[model samples]
Target chain A: MGETSARATHVQHGSHIDTIESVDAVFREQRKLSFAYGAVFFVVTLAIPAMSVWWKSWYAVPIWGGFTANYLFVSLLYYLFLWGLSWTYIKKADALDERLSHMADEIAAATLAAAEGGES
Target chain B: MGNLNIIAIVMVIGLTVFTVGLAIFVRRFTRTTADFYLAGRKVGTIANASAISGDYLSAASFLGVAAAVYASGLDGVWYAAGFAGGFIVVVLFIASALRRFGEYTVADFAFGRFGSSRIRLFTVVMVLLTSLFYMAPQMYGAGTTWTVLVGAGMFGLSPYQTGVVIVGLIIMFYVMVGGMKGTTLNQIFQFWWLWTAMFLVVVFAFTAGKFNYAKGLEEVTAENHRDVKTVTVAELTADDAALLASVETAMSEKGFAEVQAVVDAGDPDATVGVLIPAKNKLHTLRDMFFNEPGHRYNAFDQFSMVLALVLGTAGLPHILNRYYTNPSGSAARRSTFWVLVFIGTFYILAPIAGLAGKLIIDDAWRAGLAPANAAYVDGLLLKSDAIMPTLAQILGGEWLMGAVAAGAFAAMFSTTGGLLIASASAIGHDVYEKYINPDAPEARKVLVGKISVLFFAVVALGIGLGIPAVGLDKAYPALIAMMVTWAFAVGAGAFVPMLLTGIWWKKTTERGALAGMLVGGLGSFFFIIMNILKQLGHLPSEGVLAFVGSLTFPTLFTFPAALLTIIIVSKIDGQLPKNVDEIWMRIHGTASERHEKELGLDKVSTMFGNSKH
Candidate 1:
């Protein structure tokens, strides 16, 4: 009984520390991904104004049937890009969360196993 | 009212009644606070998406985009683009995470995340301010619609004031009774009504008006390409004089005198007439849709407006509240995707409506169906906010006008309803339940919510009635869009930085969030108030004051200030909340994990809970 209690106490402490580290690591990675996505989006969206200001003639160039490059990009392409980025982020973020959850469960199981082994 | 206007009035009244009836029908289902605020968090993906789109497509979008395009051409189309692009930001950074946070209001999320009543209190203020700013525009739009459609006062009130009070009362009733579920249902219907009405107008314009899109483009482009010469006596050579003689022969005595006076002036180069190249006889689409910046925006203006819209969308309390209606984080993400799809489709139709309006007006002028003098057209120009309604009258007569009037009303009602619910939730759920009466019964909380809705409606109505009297209506030609953009700018400046940082950063202390909100909120408010003062002629009209005033949407300055303040203050106050990890876990975890953690359920049971079976 004494051995099991001591082992349980040690595993609980170790697992608690591991959980915090894991959560932080996962969160950091997610934040990095979010920042990367946000930066790319910002650059792409910023091009609308940049083109309007510095490259004035670019807006006049016809890219599609009766639509100028500026018109097509501003009206349609940017929205599609935003949608695509969001879709990709959701997919990847969901997968990351799933992996984190699985890792947490495994750690919890290992801690429980250590306690059981001490009891045996 | 004219027979045609009476028909439109009837349609508007019918729509209001139908919507109120729908709300009453849905009231039976809303027993709990969850149902009242978030429809028990059980809304389906498509329904919620539809509701979001409905809530989003305000009077500004329904009518203002069309008016903007008609007036400013491609520069106007940027409004639609920026609005649609904003949802992208929401989808990426806000939607799912907000849903996962599991809060009734944004203030609730702030309180939960920071564990601070002060932040919650501040959040309530910001949320109410944002929602009121948003709602006021819809109320203004409703008034505009009434003036154009009815053209008279009612019960000793001007048409504008009558419209404000009537719409306010109806919205208050439905929102108080139906809550979020009814609002969502009504919004979906409203979106469809708007879409269908717009679609019908486009179809009619194409079929009846014989709108040749390519030819129209070519003609407009060629006309714009022509070298314009001022029609003055000094500038007029022999050929120009002969052309001016022909133009004078066609003009009435008053018109001829107006032109002659310009010629008589010492400044003979007065812009009496634009001289086009004789070879540029053919009209093209490009000429009609002049694709350039100076018509409406300068370089800085476009960037500021776009930035406000993109960031402001995520910060909007009403929009964020829609996410709370989703069952799970993934569902919120899906709903946002669907919202993009729905709204993207809606925005594409707006410019088409504008193009159709232009063509109709032009054809009317050529066919002698319109008034002979330019003054009437000038009057119409002053009320450019009424372009959509005027177009409906021109293209499809009274019945079509009625349909469009109804659609416009729906747009205003749905947007107002959403804003009311959001404001009420902030006051009732966040402030009243949390701070005022912590142990208040669910029913009492809902009663408070209903009262808040009534209070907000009255406030909005008062502002709407005052707008025209204050000359704000005349001051802003695109009144609906301008007011809506102001709200977006304020929301972006105030809430977006804090929301993004709270969700993504662990070191975001309550003090940092508070500082961010105050700086951002007050900064945006200061700029907006300054601009208003400038408009009222109480401030300088040139230099930096004019430049700042000209921004219209000041998110460019305020958003960065708020974000920087949050970061700096958070770094200085290095103490992280004790429950940061738990909050992160709740926000970032999978459905099964969150369920397990929240309910203290075992993994197997959580797995079962997550499964379809």
Candidate 2:
């Protein structure tokens, strides 16, 4: 079980702290990044079938031998699209996590310092 | 091929022996519940990715994808792409958060996130149901592959029954003995074996079978797509004569003569195998072609199925459980990326094997050189599901066929092993340890987990046996792929909505998650049962029940409906778990990760280390 999840407003790992407000900021950023990529993924994925169903050329007309646009895209190219999307998403996400880790520590330190100064 | 291929049987036996031996060897490492269920969280990125790929790619990808492509054309190819594309959802939306907020199983995540015993129990039921749905097809594949390989029964059991019982028992024994660590190692090895087998078959297709991709596809598409079936004379000659003329047009004279001779026998119930032109379900007016859409799916299904496959992946209990094996959230994300690359390559090769079969098998059959074990109608395979082994035999003969046969069993073993682990954890960890007896010793808990595996394996064996009796094997073309998609639909409906909302939407209440799961999960169950019953002729085709049953995949409707229900119900309820802030930090926070990084705990270690538990 996560110790933080036991009802603390903050999770401290050594000196690094995840205050509720810090995590909320991180959450908003992550949500934005994830949803932005998610929008593209769903659009491209759903569009394959949408076009296959509605557009004649997409499903019917063969561009290379018997490889219709739908057949070619679904069978071959869509994977490249996935590989590209996931690869870039992971790189960006890892970078975001790294950047936010520092920001979260700063925010937590500032909170702790303010409390100490006020008490003195 | 059903004929006694000594080499293929020997290969399969050899693989089985190796798998069992590996399980026994890993049995010593099985100590804590974490070790038993999550491999002690020591798994590396690439290795975990390999295991995840093996767990994800079942007999559905190995046999069903090619068979589906051979049978349904463009729509069939979606099975491959949809499957590989699913990891996108995992990496983007689910993987990192699940790993960070992780426990052992999906049920654990549910309970922890929602903070309730009620939700946990409900999640456990959904987990078990989802596992069984996925396991059913693997069981079916076992029987089908066994019939293809051995061609005989043992101890008075039919060949299919022999396969089902033996496979079920072997997997049960191994999973019980080794636990998750053993399963993870085996999954990595099995994944490579199957990937190599698929690659070899495709390579053989190009080199030995002399197949050219675009040209071969063009050749196959030169003729209209057709379906092969075994039909009784009465049905064939029934009002409107739906099948009589088309049989003649689609079949060769000799093939049609076989049907004609059966008709001339004057037995109304006499069955004959024949080929008939396929109908376009999508367009309705266009002729079905080998390269065109809608041999199996209509427009609604085309979208629904893709949704099910992609979204449903994030919801699968077994796959979700794999995320916990990762050391950190970033590692989980990296593992998913590797998984996509591994499976994407395999998916690309599968349809080529299908296309190769379409181009090569008919010629081999005409030459009277096709493997003798497979049934054929007008040079078309009687059961397209036999394409993997059958095609392997034609291209590279016994050696290649043996490799593919072993690969098929590996697929079943890897997947069923994972599902058994997931199902066992759902009961043993989520139910027994948490609710029944929290103070039980580790050994007792391990025993209970093993017992749970035994129970579910028996259930899976029964499902394998029942498939043939209920005519489910005949109810759909490429039955393995279709059935797996049904499992995906259930997962997508049940878990994706809840997980997506629970992780992403903070306002999501327990009542909302439960309501969403009930509607999405049970709704999918209802629709699937109705669809199966309708296909098996146990339901009417003219009423409201029939209309609901006609939906081939319910994810398109069920997913959104479930999501909306969650929002509305949560809005009305307006209550949240008291520890919501802590839960939020756990889900989105990086302090644990930063702490781990400082202690160098983020670095993955070897699971084979001598420190048991």
- Highest DockQ against the true fold, candidate: 2
Give residue B513's error in model 2 in angstroms: 0.4
| Per-model TM values vs. the true structure | 0.84, 0.98
| Standalone chain B TM-score for every prediction | 0.86, 0.99
Q: Which stretches of model 1 miss by more than 4 angstroms?
A: A1-19, A61-66, A93-101, A107-120, B1-3, B221-289, B365-380, B591-613
Give the number of the best model, judged by lDDT: 2
Clash pairs (backbone) in predicted model 2: none
DockQ of each: 0.25, 0.86
Candidate 2: docking tier? high
Candidate 2 regions off by >4 Å?
A1-7, A115-120, B610-613
Candidate 2 global TM-score? 0.98
lDDT of 2: 0.91
Expressed as tens digits, the lDDT of each residue in B1-613 for candidate 1 is: 4223767778878888889998988887787788888877767788888999999999989988887776666677788888888987887778777876777888988888888999999888998888888888888888877777876667988777777888888898899999987898899999899888887777777887676554554444443322222344664434657756654544546545766677667574555543232221112222323554445556666788889988989989999999887766767777888888788877877877776666676567556554221213311233556777777777787677888889889999899999999999998988888779989887898899999999999999988888877767655546788788888988998889999999887789888988999999888988887777777666787888876776666888999999999999999998787767666655653433344345542112210011221
Model 2, native contacts kept: 0.94
- Candidate 2 lDDT over B400-433, as tens digits, reads 9899999999999999999999999999999999
Which 10 successive residues of model 1 chain B have the least lDDT summed?
B604-613
